[model samples]
Target chain A: MTFKLFSEHLLIVVAAEVLALAVGLPLGVLCYFSPKARKPILWVVDVLQTIPALALLGIIMVLAGAGKQTVIIGIALYSLLPIVQNTNLGLLQVDPGVKEAACGMGMGRMYRLIHVEFPLAFPVVFTGVRIAAVNAVGSAVFAAFVGGGGIGTAIYKAIRIQNMNMLMQGTATLMAIAIALDLSMGWVEARIKRGHSSMKKAPARRN
Target chain B: MIKFEHVSKKFGKKQVLDDMNFEIPDGQFVVLIGLSGCGKTTTLKMINRLIEPDEGRIYIDGKDIEKVDKVELRRQIGYVIQQIGLFPNMTVAENICVVPKLLKYDKESRDRIVHEMLDMVNMPYDEYAHKYPSEMSGGQQQRIGVLRAFAASPPIVLMDEPFGALDPMTRETLQDEIKKLQKKLNKTIVFVTHDMGEALKLADTIIFMEDGKIVQMAPPETMLENPANDNIRRFLGKHMNDDAVTLTVEDFMRTNIITVDKHRGVRECTERMARTGVDTLLVVDESDKYIGTVSIKDIRLRGKNEKLIEALITDNAKTVRRDGDAHECFDHLLNSGDNYVVVLNNDDTIAGIVTKNSMAKALSDTLWGDER
Candidate 1:
């Protein structure tokens, strides 16, 4: 039963991460290329990140009508801050010399971003992805309150019935998942960092 | 040819280029020289449309650059910068092929270009082709940067202090290489640098600017013989002072001399001579002590059968100590039929060369003070 709940929780986090990346990468790039959009977009995502995960799920449930959809949407929205901010910061920190050379070489906007800028900024962007992934794992626990099935539902029932055994198993399972996800993602981040030895550290981001 | 008609620019309230008017003739290496904020960089960026003028038009080969699509226009012109600007993400070959790739060059052509460009700088294709920029030294990275600019074989190139960040030794080597490449490719190069020594060494014409205005524009020799104002005189300070204070071989020698190892192959020696535009080369021993000189004429006459420059070395050129009397050297140059006299250091290493041109330049500087 615990194993089943862990997989479902993993599924929601993965889906939300995918959704967030798809929407957030371009949004970050848009913010980079268009300075006018940067402030407002960052502000919106910053606001999204500050909302309590349970409160965010409740709000999303009202709009999407309760289910896994609401939980996914809520987690995805909550995770957008790190991804979008990191993308914009990563591109900004790219060596100005390289960017100028790309411009001087006659590369179009998209061509430069794909061929030169994006690759240099990849390590930093991936750091953001890692942060979002880890955060989503924790945020996915809000699934129980919005009627989404996951380990959170088991924990919620354990709390209501005062079942110490079930509560310990559910909490322990969540901790294990979070730790495993963090370590594996951290390993992948290290490999990406090794690949781009010239990359600067990602700018600090606020949760 | 590039012509700027009434080109002007202002950054905020400060005028950066005030109605700058100039023309860069085809195949000429024109260097724009000035202080840091004198609009030299702004002027160079305008040609590539990296910065547009507030009021005026820039014409490339008689067409207004404003009318051309910037991306299309930039692809046709090459550019190099002070920061080396090599894309760290790409391999040496990939970085050099950036422009060609953008132009949709076929795979074969791109590979050929990568090989040819690396070969031109003596970087073998098979070895350096896949190495990333971070793996190479600063000098090598800048060399790749230069090759990237010239990859598409653009007819015009703009260099903004391209060697500024390199060490003095590396800067000198890259300067020689760039001047040779500019001549070999017959490209019109507009270079910007604050170093007058560099400007005089590589420029066919030097344009001196101050306060967003052209202070003077002339050949290196003309600028040396006749500076426009006190600013130029100050800019030419140490160089002028060298002529005025002491009449010695050190004061009159051209230190930008080219030398070849005594054991170098005849073909390599001749190639070096051709690249540096010198008819003779000072051959140095294994310890870098001067042995003698080799002339192109002797190479043509008797070097046909010889494989190494060692066998072709001749004592026809006279050698003088670095501290030797300047007037005596001048007299020897005038009376002796030798083309140049080699100036040597105390340890018997070659210091520089004193030819008729340098002697004449020193003489002119003596006759005409920096005032006029």
Candidate 2:
């Protein structure tokens, strides 16, 4: 029973993360190039972040009419803030010296951006994805309220029935999943940092 | 040959190159030198079309550069700049072969070129080729930058203060390496620098500029001897003052000397040598031009009065240009039994004679003047 709930919960969060990155990255890249779109796009995302999670999920539920579709849409929208902001920030943070070196070597604009600028920005962009992944664990629980059953539904039922054993098991499972996900994501972040030696906070290189 | 005809460039209100006309012969190493804002760099970049001239035309090998595609022209002209310009993400070999790759050389050839260039710079190909730019020191990185420029074997290479950022020792090593490359490859090079010492040491011809105008274009020796104006004199400053002037043979040469016609009788030549308190006389032709030297010993052994001094003349007599460094002649005189080095003008006419006594007297005077 717990396995089924954990699987459903993991699927929703992962799906939301993948969807958020796809939509946010291109939108972020577009904002990076076009000044006119930057202001409006960033404002909308910022406003989306300020909206209460349950309130936003309720609004999405009204439009999509509940279940996994509404829950997934709500969580993806919630995660867009970190993904879009970081994509923009990462690109903007690429060293000007590196860009100048690339252009001087006769690399065309598109080639330089893709091959030189984007690679340099990758570690920072991945940090945003990691942050969104961890945050999505908590946000995915909202799916239970909309009748999109996950680990959240089991915890909800345990609380209503005052069953101490079920409550402990449900809460312990979420805690365990969160701890495991955070540790694995942290390891991935460390790996990302190691790949780019030039970055300031990059850990001591292995022999 | 590269020629700039009435070239001018302006950046808003600032005129960088103004009606500049110059010619650089094939295989000559030319250095453009001046103060920071004097447009020496602009002049070099104009050749590769990095910075285009606002007016007038530039021709390389009698073909207008404007007619050539800018990208193609840049690829053909090797360019090394102050920043070293090596892409940090690229390995040394990759950076060196960037232009060669652009030119579409096969993988085998590009790899071979990379190894060859690093080898020429004395950086082992195996050790440095796969290493990224950040892995090397600033000097090593710049050495890769230079090797990259020459990888395609371009007919002309342009350097804009390529070693300006290195320490003195590394700069000297790279300068020597580039000089060797220039000689071995026989490529026409246009180098730009604000460093006068670098200009003097490397240039076959140094073009000194003031306010976007070429104040003087002459060889290092000529430039030191005759600066075009007071502005140039001030720019030359200490370099022209104590070291160059005192060390030059022209300042110490004895201007008034007699030349014996190579066809003159040995009897007359011996008489002249005796009268001048000298054992030898300079042998010249009937045109009153220099031929060689005839010693009294040679004249005596060939005692026939009808025998011409030309018969006794030894062709091994050394000659030095009047504008040449006196120390060079000084060192030569110290190592040889010869009393003098014949000093000649640009026209090759005898300017004067520089002997051990003449240079000593001139140097002693400067030392005493300094003491006073």
| Top lDDT prediction, candidate number | 1
Candidate-wise lDDT, in order: 0.89, 0.83
Which consecutive 10 residues in model 2 chain A have the weakest lDDT in total?
A198-207
DockQ for every prediction shown:
0.31, 0.13
- The candidate that achieves the highest DockQ relative to the unseen native structure: 1
- The window of 10 residues in a row where model 1 chain B has the poorest summed lDDT is B238-247
The regions of model 1 sitting more than 4 angstroms off are: A198-207, B241-372
Question: For model 1, what is the error of residue A170's alpha carbon versus the real structure, in angstroms, after optimal superposition?
Answer: 1.3
Task: Write one digit per residue (lDDT tens) for candidate 1, span B29-82.
Answer: 999998889999999999999999999888999999999999999999999988
Across B22-55, the per-residue lDDT of candidate 2 in tens digits comes to: 9999999999999889999889888988788999
Local error of candidate 2 at B294, Å?
18
lDDT of 2 by residue, A62-168 (tens): 99998988788888888888888888888888765455445545565666778777777778788888888888888888889998878889988988988888878
Highest TM-score against the true fold, candidate: 1
